[model samples]
Every structure is written in structure tokens, then in C-alpha cells.
Target: MKPLVAIVGRPNVGKSTFFNRMIGERVAIVEDMPGTTRDRLYGDTDWNGREFTLIDTGGLELGSGIPVGQVGLTGQPGDLMDHVMSQAQLAIEEADVIIFMVDARSGITAADDEVADLLRRSTKPVVVAANKADNAERRLDVVEFYGLGLGEPTDISSIQGTGTGDLLDRIVEALPPASEMEEEEDENIPRIAIVGRPNVGKSSLLNAVLGFKRSIVSNVPGTTRDAIDTEVEFGEQKIKLIDTAGIRRRGRIGVGVEKYSVLRSTRAIERCDVALLLIDASEGLAAQDTHIAGIIHEMGKGVIVIVNKWDIAQEQIRAEREGIYPDPDDEIQSAESYRKALMGALKFIPYAPIIFASAKTGYHIKSILETALKISDMRYLRVPTSRLNEVVQEAVRRHHPAAVTAMKPLRVYYATQTRVNPPTFVFFVNDPRSVHFSYERYLENRLREAFSFYGTGIRIFFRARSSKEER
Candidate 1:
């Protein structure tokens, strides 16, 4: 395992800015508002070939237990202090080194002092960063943090990217050597991340699937703020399950802990081999659901669309009141309507298989495991080279590629399976540039027809075969 470096500081102290700088991309949403980040956001960075995982945590508050009725940047009530503190504490627990950031302009405050006190209790190495030290005048502000008793504070500007190299040097020195940091391998186990918006029955689905209360399930939104991982054995297969926080739309992502929740949920998606994207059946398809599905697709993970709260959806169907059961046709009609709406919204992920389940009544919950296993198998499925070339030849013969210019028709020389786990195939052709997107889709459809790669993503790569190689 790479060393975990966590950035912790007060609200609006430029933790997100620092994270974005280190990662060389604007991942964490940065805003002028205080408490803009809520959960533990993670990113990976390497300097001088020394790679480490960085976590951006919400601002730490000291005395005030919670932010009650305080207006935030979005004009909503700020009640995330407790959640922020909890998430920060969790980050600290998981971190190998802590980068405690402080505002250079504000000088030392009670919150910084409190956070310093909290860090001193942990055995993890702590590095103090005095951010916003953009100029010579502001650089002198680093002296104020010397009283925190961690060490000489590193002065830097997150926005301007100054002094970050020295800070990273300090972190690499404080971290354990890479040889000692390597963790035992568990790559064979299939990891699944359960993700969705808040109060969408994510935790309930987890509990029902595991047949126990592995995760905290409550009616309240944002109950599970951290990505909790559990390993279980079912049908002689050991699989890792990650239950993540609900992901809301960017506009609805309230400043503070909730933002971190979204980041962690995204990280979970990145780490998983398969993602069980849960949607609320009662709520139907929403924009956020579509966005979440896009994330899974972008990650190229095997996915299963789980429609939770099927019991509640059945209650809404207006069927003949002859008995407690509904008419079979009504159920079929409702299912078809839902399938159409979902298929339309998630046309990009047409390969994802859908299952309607109810965690409350254990309805079709076991099928999730069955489908997930099939998807996992499909992800690792490899097609023989002879069989792959045969399929490609047949596809090309059926519909010749349209000419790129006027009379120069594209030619497929040969094809081979390059890799598996979202199986990738490489095709050696006359001119790789002439392979249009539609032609690529046509080839993919033909390959899928010949091979059952259901519930798994596949990639087709076109490479130019030189004349000498053709000879």
C-alpha cells in the first residue's frame, strides 16, 4: 500500500487548492465558501517516482460541536461541523502522515490549536504547512505556527504552487520506505462498490445482501459518510464489498462534509472491479443517477443497475383491488415502463443488466450476487486468437469499411485479443486512421454477437500494419 497523506485544516484554509496542486488537476471542487468540503477526498500524486495517496479532508472545528443554522455559501443552513470532524478523524486514523494546513493570514487560532492537540495524540508523523504565504511579507506569518509544536512550518501558496516541492520532500522523508510500505496482495478477490445518492437505500441494500447489519442503515440522509469495506465469502468465492456515501449533484453538494462524501464515493468507484449502482425505485430515474452511471462507465467497470425499493414501487401501482396481490399484467406494465425510462436515461451503458429488488422484503436480493458473478466472469473472459480473427473477418466481410477519401476503402489485416478484464482487442489494419467510430462500434457488436461479453465493457484498438509486416 502507498503511504496515505491526509491534508487537514480549518474551513477555507486552501486544503482543496493544495490537493488540486499536488494532483496536477482540479479534482476537488474549490470555492470561496467556508466548509465547502465535507468528506475525505482522495487523490494520487508522485514526486521523484515516490507515489502516495493524498486525502483532502473537511475543515476541522474545535469547540463548536456542530454548525447549526449558520448560513453557508449556498444560503443553506450549515450543520456539517460534526460530520466534518468525524470524517477528519477517520482520515487521521487511516493516514500514515498528516499535512496540517493553517491559514498564514489568520495567524494561530483556537481551531488550529485544537487540531494540533488532536494530532499530537496520534503516533503518525505530522507536517505543518502555512498556506497562503504567497509573498515575502506573508512568508513571515509561518513563525506564528511554530507554537503548535509539530515542527518548523513549511511556507507555501496552494494557488501559486510555491514551496510545494519542499513540502513534498518533507512528506517523502517522513514516510516509510517503499519496500516496507508494500501491503499483502488481494488482487484475486473481486471488489464491488455499492454507490448511489443519499437515502437511496445503499446501506440497506448492503445489509440485505450480506444478510446482516454490516453498515449503519438509517432513514436519515448522509448516514454513512465514509467508504466502509467488508470482505465476505459467498458460494466459495471471497469478494470485497465497499459501501460508499451518497453522491448528490454538484449543485446540491452542500459545502463541507458532503463534498468529501462525493469524492470518497468516486474513489470507491475507481478502486472497484465491479460497481452495483443502486437507484431508488420509488424516486425513479433522476439526473444524479444518470451522472453516477456515467462515472461507472467512464471507469470501465462491470456494472449492475439495481433498482431498490421495489416493494414501495409496487405499492404505487394502481391495480384491481381484488386481493392483496396485484394483477400480473399491471406488474409487467410497470416493470416495462421503468425499464424503458431507465434505458432511455442510461443509453450509454446499455450493456449494464438491470435487476429490481427490495431490501425490505428480501425480494430478488440474491440475484445480485448471481449477476455480479456473471459480470465478473465476463470481465475476465478471453477470446482465442483464432476465434477473434474469425469473428473480425466475418464482420468485415458483412459490411466493408467506407472509403476515408474517395476510393481508398479501409482494410482489416488481422485482429488479436490484447487483454481481458474489460477485454481489449487490437486490430492490425491497412490504415488505423481510416477506422471510423461507427465502424469500431460495428466491429464491437459483431464480436459481442460471437462472444457473450455481457455486463462487461470492451475496447477495440486499431493499429496500422506496415507493408513489410504484411509481406
Candidate 2:
């Protein structure tokens, strides 16, 4: 269990910069403009041997703070500042410790003073950070924040990495001790990560499932820069829906934070129980989708193929109609053929169950949840050693491994299930190199056929047996 510390303040107050600095990574998108970070981005941080999760929230404006009883912040009628204030108020309620960041270079603005007044009423411990104090001149400006009455302002530069240690130390001290509620213990909770290229409705699907606008959905690509987790109980099952950054192909990623985001997404797949590999139904799958699916397969995580924006897809199909398909069933068959073609484009993830969904319209969203639960169940399946051996023998008998270099035939001595989650199997063979990739695929297919391990990725390892060990 780790304490939850939320970084809160007005827009462009260097909150995202401070968050990225505290996490020791560029988990949040740092932009010069305000209102860039619309949703709360969660990342883990360790300070003084105490680990905690940090949440970077949208900036708060003045006077629009929602009352405590509402689900979240309600926008005020008057101006933009009011909406920002309401969001900040909502952030205060969610945080265990609030790191109220302000710009020292700009000195204190009226919005800062208004947010400070709101923080004064919060029961949570607050650490006022005067960011962008990179030099001695700005350090004097840091003193001006004391007028807010929240105590001393810790001057630090988030970009230059100056004086952040003291700020983190103060933050750790202010954070409540880690508790059991923060720790996740449920093995049955299906961790489904929603992943896709940018602006493909990954966040929208998450929001639809939660039945609220949980993650920030914008028309802009790359709006979501960090992975966000939200738990929802869907149809008698508890699922942890993870929305990850839209991943681009390795070569296409420019340098800096965008590249780091792709790396983070790879790590997210490794940690997740199942990956909801989302693709734009209207645009269809691309080379990047195959690359992402390959990562999921390599990690041996269960996968569910989510084709988002299906409503748009239907309209597109209707526009493309020709005299070739006169009947409705024929049109459906044509659409199914088109889907199969898309699946062919993403052939790397052959085992994943594909579902058509519109995250915006909430079309077939329930099926997505059902598919995730099925995949999670499949990942945890355990086949008995005896059953596995029988399947292996039958498979080998049906299709033997090809002979290596025309010298000797590859013989599989025995096979056993090595792990349950993701269902890994190890086969002892006469020569590991002699066992070809096609043969491994054959064995996996056979195992799936025998045990019904559908919607789960399977891994197979071949170990060469020494002469002495064989004897």
C-alpha cells in the first residue's frame, strides 16, 4: 500500500513539470501552454524509502469550486477561472496530500490567491511549491507565496531539477502512512489495459465503462500521456481498466517524452493481466497495431481486440456500398470480410478475441467487459501434467518436428505446464534448435484445442536434454 499524493494548482503552474520531476520521469506531458493536463495521471514515486502514487490533476480556476456532495467538479457559470477552481476543489477531495504548486517567476496571480484560499479549508496536508525558481533572483520571488498563508514556500525548478529533493522530502512528510486500502490484493480482478494509437477512443472506452468521464477525451491526438487506472464492477466481475498512451512505431517516435511514453506502455502490458488492443474501426488496423500486438504476445498477456468507432464504420460501409451486395445479410457478410481483412493486417495477435464497439455511443461495451473476464479466466487456467502430456503426444504424432540439417530428427522427450497464469509450457527435446517455430505453434494450437484456452496468449519453451540427463 502506498499513499496517494495529488499535485494540484492552477493551469501552467508547473504542476506537470513538478510531477514529472518527482516521479523522476516524464510521465506527464509538460507544455508551455495552460490546460494541457485535463485528467489525473497516476505514477509511482519513492521518497525516503517510502513509496507513494502521485496523481497529476487538471489545473484549478477561481470561484467555480463544486460543493463536496457532487460526483466531481461542476463548472461554474461565470468564467473559465470558475471551472478551473471547481476542478481544483475536486482534486483536493481526492488527494491524501496536496502539493499546491505555483509559479515563482510569474510571482502570484489572482487565481493562485483564490486557489490558496480554497486549500486553506481542506483537511488534507498541503505543501506549497514555488516552482521555476531556477536562480537566486527567482528565489526572492518564492517568498511572495508566503502571503497565501499556507506556510513556507519550497522554491524549486522542475525543469532544471533544482531543489526538488527538499520539496519531495516535505511531500513525503506531509503524506499519510501507506494503508491496506491502497494495496491491490484481489487475484480475480481482471487488469485490462486499453491500448492503441493516439485518438482512437482508448480513453473513451474507459470512460464509457466507468459510466462517467473518468479520463480526459479530446479530439487531439497524444492528449493522454500517462496510464490511468480505474476500477469498475461490470456484470458480477471487478475489472481494473487501464488507459495507456497511444503507441507509435519505434522508428516513428521522435526523441524525448513521447519515446518514453512508448516504453511505459510496453511495461504496462507486462504488468496487465489482459490487454484490450484497440484499433480505429473506421481507419482499420495499421503496422503500429501489429507491433503493439507483438509486444502483448511477447509478454504472454491475454488480449482482446477492440475495434472502436463502429458507428462511424457502419456509416462508411453504407457510403461505400455497390450493386454487388443487394441483400442486408450480404452486406453483413461483406462487412465481416472487411473485418477479417483488418484482422489479417494484425495477424500477430491471432489468438485475441475481436469485438466491434463504439466507446462514444456505448455500443457493445458490455461485450468488451465480458470478453475481458473470459480472457482473464483463461490466463489463470491450469492443465494437469498428465493431460498436457497426452495432448503433446497426440500433437507430436500428428505433426512431428522437422529434422535439423538432414542429420537427425527432433524428438520431444516430454512436456509439462510450467506456469498457470498465461499458461506457459516447457518441452524437453533432443535438440532445442531443431524444434522449429512452426512446430511450437502446432503444439500451442493443439493444447488450446484440447483444453479450450481461448482468448489467452500461450508461451512455449524448448529445452535441449543432455545425453547424461536423458540416460
Candidate 3:
């Protein structure tokens, strides 16, 4: 799990501006978690080699005119201001390290003092950042923050990108050691995650696959509040299945355990080797379903689309078999027809194989296991350098890359597999920019053809040939 870093301060304190620069500079993990209402406030970043998630307290504003001692993080929030402060306490409670932002020009205010008191009471590691310290005069004013008693403030200009690097260095040092939070997992076993929208039969599907009631099935949405990990033996193989809470639409934390449940669902995707994406067969696919699939593809995880509640879908199909509503598009009324439309809807992840199954009756339950095992093998499949280069050279010979400029066309000298587990391949090319997006897709298709990577998303990278290699 990545360490959680909270950037806390009063509103207009440059927290959002600072957050954007950190992630926009490519110094962060750019893969987004869809449907998060706090998307802007939450960002995944890394300094040196240590990656951590940044939680911006931009929305946690303490309204003006409130006295220092009157404000409190206790009890449930009443008004909008109290609601925002309640969220601030949420960040404070979950963060492994805190980055307290302050304005150098304004000096310390009552809000800043209250925030400092909140941090001091928690006793967590705090790194003070004095924003707007662009000039020598403002830099001198940074000392006023030291009086807040957090520590010596790091002077920075979030807009100009001055002193942010040193501030990042301090933030990295203050983070808890990486090993302390690492949860060990068995590499030999194939870890699978059952994920989809709420009430889509994710828990029920897990129970069907296990041939027993493992997760509590319910009609209510967002029933499971946390990730449930269970290890069991299927046939001769031992595998781990992670059942997570349902993710609500629009990133809204409405009722009970909203934040914790959503966090668990996203974290489950991060740790899984293969994701079993369940979709409702009766309602077909929706926008939220595709959003979840997009996140899975972006993470480069092996995925198998399970159309849950097919039994219910069959009942609906039976009613419409006589062409009650004639439609040319959906001419055939069978699984084959539904599959064609399903593939069209999920054209982005065309590589993922879809399985139509019912969680109630245990239909096609064995095939799910078989396909998952096959995908696990495909994710870790490696091709030898000689065979890879031969395939690449043949692919280029068949259809040469289009010329981006009149002077130089794209030329690939050699290619090799650099990593496995969603296998990544690196190609030494004459010019990386000359390779277009469509050409990359063509290459990926050819590689999939040669290697038969059915359900796993593979990675391909192109880099300029080194001068030494050119010689």
C-alpha cells in the first residue's frame, strides 16, 4: 500500500495549485481512479523512488470570522463549514505524513494556529510549506510559521516551482519507512479480484465460484464495507479471491462507511493480478461499468468480464423472443447476439474475454476458473529475444511504418521483452516520435497474434537507439 500524505491548510493557501504541479510534472502516478468526487484533492505521487498518495485539503476550508478556540473537529458536522472541517479530520486521521501549507505574506492567522493545534495533538510527522515565498522579502517572512511550533517551515512558491523539490525531499524523509506498511503476499498463488458496480452480483458470483456462501449476498447497494480476502483451493490449485465493496457513482460518500468502502474497492484493484469484472446481464452495460473497466485496462491488469445474473437475463430474453419490439440492430435474440453488442460496448478492452454466468444457479462456474487460470499464465508469458525480434522484423517487412516527416521514417533495430506479469516489451527504434499510435496498435496486435495473449493487457515501449548501440 502507498503511504497517504495529507496537504492541509486554509482555503486559497495554494494547496490545489501545488497538487497540480506535483502530478502534472509527471512526478506522480497518473492512472486515475474513476468516479472519485475528491478526484482533484486526491493524487498519487512519488519522490525519488518512493510512491505515495497525496490528499489535498482544498475543500476542508475553515470559514472566515470563526474564532480560533471555537472551531472543533468533534461530533458530526452540521453546516457546510463544519462539514468541510470534518473532512479535514478524516485526512488527518488517515495520513501517514502531513504537509501543512501556510501563506508567507499573510503571516500566521487564527485558522493556521488552529490547524497547527490539530496537527500537534495528533503527533504525526508534519512538514510546513510556506507558499508565496518567491522573493527574498517573502522568504524572510517564512520564519513566522516556525512560531506555529510544527517545525522550521520550508519556503516555497507553488506557482513558480521554487523550493518545491527541497520540500518534496523533506516530505519523503518524514514518510514512514516503506517496509513498515508492506503486506506480504504469496507470489506463487494467482490473486484475483471480483469487481463491478453495486448490486451487480460480485459477492454472489464469488459464492457461486466457491460453491459456498463466502461473502454475504444482499439486495442493498454498497453492502460490503471493506475488502474481504479469502484463500481457497480450486481443484489442485490454490488461489486468492478478493471481494470488495460496491463503488457508487459520482464519487459521493453518502451514508455509512462511504469513504472506507470506496477506498477498499480501489485498493483491491491495485493489488490484484487478475480482475474479474462483473456486469449485469439483465440491464446490460452502463457508463459506470465501462468506467471500472477503463481503470482495469489502465492498470494493465488481466481482466475477465463476467456477465452476472444471466438467469435473470434469460427470463427477459424469453419474453422478447417473439419480436415484440422489432429492431434491426439486435436482430438475433440469444447469447451470441448479446455478445456481439457487448463487445461493441467494450471495444476499448477488446482483448478481454466475456463469460455469461449466473451466480444463483452456478452456471458456467467452472469455465470462469479455467479462463482465469489461462489468463494468469498469459500475463506472465515471456518470449525469447530471438523469436521476438524475428516476429517484429517480419511484422515491419509486411507493412512498413508510415513516415511522420519527409526526412526520416521510423525504423526498428531490435526488440526484447523487458518484463513479465502484464508483459512489457521495449523496442530500440531510430526515432521514438516517428512511431504513431496506430502503428503501435498494429504492433501490439501482431504480438498478440504471435503470442496469443487473450485476456491480458500487454505493454509496449519505444525508445531512441543509444549512440553506443548505433556504432
lDDT of 3 at 175: 89
When summed lDDT is taken over every stretch of 10 residues in candidate 2, the lowest stretch is: 62-71
**Candidate 2 on 1-471: residue-level lDDT in tens?**
456677777778788888887777887777786655544466788888888778776433233233221213453354545554665666676567888888888888877887788889888899999988989999987889899999999999988989889988998888776664345547878788988888899889889989999889998877787778788888677888788888986545532235446645765686689899888988877888888888888778888888889889777777777524356686467568866986787666667778888999999898988878888988888888898898889888888777868546899989888887789999998878787777777888888889988888888899988889889
lDDT-superior candidate, 2 or 3: 3
Better lDDT candidate (1, 2): 1
Report residue 446 deviation for candidate 2 (angstroms). Answer: 1.1
Question: How do the candidates rank by lDDT, highest first?
Answer: 1, 3, 2
Task: Write out the backbone clash pairs for model 1.
Answer: 1-183, 35-256, 36-256, 37-256, 38-256, 38-257, 39-257, 39-260
- For residue 461, give model 1's deviation from the true position in Å: 4.7
Of models 1 and 3, which has the larger lDDT?
1
Q: Which candidate is the best by lDDT?
A: 1
lDDT, candidate 3, 1-471, per-residue tens: 898887877656677778878877533222222111233246688999999988654434223323222345443333543444565566677678989898888899876777777777886899999998989999998988889998899999988999999999999999889998697987778989999889999999888877788888999988886789998788889889999987767444452245656666877998888999999988888888888888899888999999889878877865777736446444245678888888998998899998989888988888998899899988888899999999999999999998987537999999999999889999999999999899999999999999999899899999999999899
Q: Estimated TM-score per prediction?
A: 0.80, 0.61, 0.81
Ranking by TM-score: 3, 1, 2
Could you give candidate 1's per-residue lDDT for residues 22-123 as a string of tens digits? 998988778876755644457789988899989886544322423222435345543454544564566677678999999998898776777787787878
RMSD of each: 4.6, 9.9, 5.8
Q: What overall lDDT goes with each candidate model?
A: 0.82, 0.78, 0.80
